[model samples]
Target: MQTEHDSTYISFSREEWASLHPSSQINLTQSEINHIQGLIGNLTNEEISKIYLPLIEYLSINMEAAKFSHHVKNQFLKKATKNPPFIIGIAGSVAVGKSTTSRILQSLLLDLPARPKVDLITTDGFLFSNNVLKAKGLSERKGFPESYNIRALIDFLSAVKSGEPCVQAPVYSHLYYDIVPGQYHQVCQPDIVIIEGINVLQTPKQVGSSIPSRVVSDFFDISIYVDADESHILKWYVERFKLLKKTAFTKPESYFKRFAELSDVEAEGVATDIWNRINKVNLEENILPTKYRADLIIEKSSNHQVDNIRVRKN
Candidate 1:
């Protein structure tokens, strides 16, 4: 890792970080890790035992402390203590493995002693529908901050933190590239909630006096940001796009179906264009700026392995 500590974070090499803990108490198998892998990256069971297992243990420690704080506050108020879901926000640039990290955390969290009911939600579900974006002239900016229903997202998270029994989040479809109308993913009272997205750490653009100034991260008990060089992420994005052409894009109803027939050279050109035009802009302007706000940052190597970890000290 680059020379340590020019910032609020304390950085450690993967081995150093792993050595901080004697061993991972969690028993996740290789096949289980494969099942949670995302489109662009692969993770082995060893990586999990060394990196994520320690992180999971850290989160569980925080969860217990939060529960205790809640109990203390309730006692001060002479009210009954209620354990709310511990919310974690996972933010990173597209194709940098945030989805895989979220899924892995959700899986590990389930085995915690609390046997927490963990629910993973992607902020893609909060994006404005393509029709709405088109009407607002933000079709090309779909992944940008303005393309999300910020108010609705905040309200949903607020309700969840308030211990609401059930809440519905809009469903988004990658194949259709739009929100699935009238479809909602119901989240019951989970013990833990992981909200994953490129912009989960972002502050909403100020609209008017009617909206609160709080950001989505305000509801998080802890947050993680997956980190990698921009060059590496761009390459991953292109690679994923190429893979999608052979997979999802081959479906007749896939919005990216046209890409399925493109030659390898043609597909590379298109992926490069899309990255340069859209995803790169979003990453540079929105996503990267929020990385420092995360409580823990996991830096990935070119091979998509967790190479370093930085935990914020202050």
Candidate 2:
């Protein structure tokens, strides 16, 4: 069967990818692994040692290469400041484990001998406020690229790339399903940063007419796409919805609190409809189209575990 791809990438089975530069040191503890695992995730330390640890080892090499290039540029320009932090971008479909993979990488990178400080930010915070979306009649398209304040997101990255001291990113709440009012994640200078979102790799032309001079991926030193069959993602999304219906949706303040009392079949049906209508459409037209743009792609199996990996040959 054909896999996700083009001639630009070389695919590797999970075993081959794990063996590329195997590391014996499992930097993350079991507790940390548990915390890194998302609602629908079953991440284990073995996977860390087998998959992510080696992945970061590859990243570290790239990071060093970037710094060397920066150093040479600085010398020619006669300046002394070190290069800006290495920025990594992660993208994938909803419920495809992008967030969990990002967190795990952040932990592993920090625990490296350099122990460089790392910050993670998600693009959810850049989403147009619920009020704004409703006003613009985009209430049904929350996760679509048009729903985001792409300029604001680009501005945040511009500041980071410029090595700004303290840049504040708007905070987003999943429970409330909106940007938090007057709240922000203050990002200080760090050795590395990871930006996570479903649409990070999307191009402006695909997004709409409001194209920035530079797209989000321009600032990324590395980009990753978490890949899985849409069928698997549909199952995962509905399962997560049902799980949340019993948990987060139960809270009175949850934006989806109305779903809290849904019966099993009712909850599944609602979630399925949402996927068919909104998320799947976004994934097809926007998210999946950008998959090949990633420097690395982690393909997952039906069980949501990494089954293969593809790295850009260039």
lDDT against the true structure, each candidate: 0.89, 0.91
Candidate 2 lDDT by residue in tens digits, 251-307? 999999999999999999999999999999999999999999999999998887898
Show the lowest summed lDDT stretch of 10 residues, model 2. Answer: 204-213
TM-scores across all candidates?
A: 0.95, 0.95
TM-score of 2: 0.95
For candidate 1, write residues 1-314 as lDDT tens digits: 54434468888899998997766655556677668986667777778889988898788789989999999999999999578889999999988999999988888888777687999999999999989999999999999998999889999999999989899999999999999999999999889999999998986566766555788999999999999998899889889998999999999999999999998889999999999999999999999999888999999989899999999886
What global local distance difference test value does model 1 have? 0.89
The C-alpha stretches of model 2 lying farther than 4 A from their native spots are: 1-4, 25-30, 206-211
Residue 82 miss distance in model 1 (angstroms):
1.2
RMSD (CA, Å), each prediction? 2.0, 1.9
lDDT of 2: 0.91
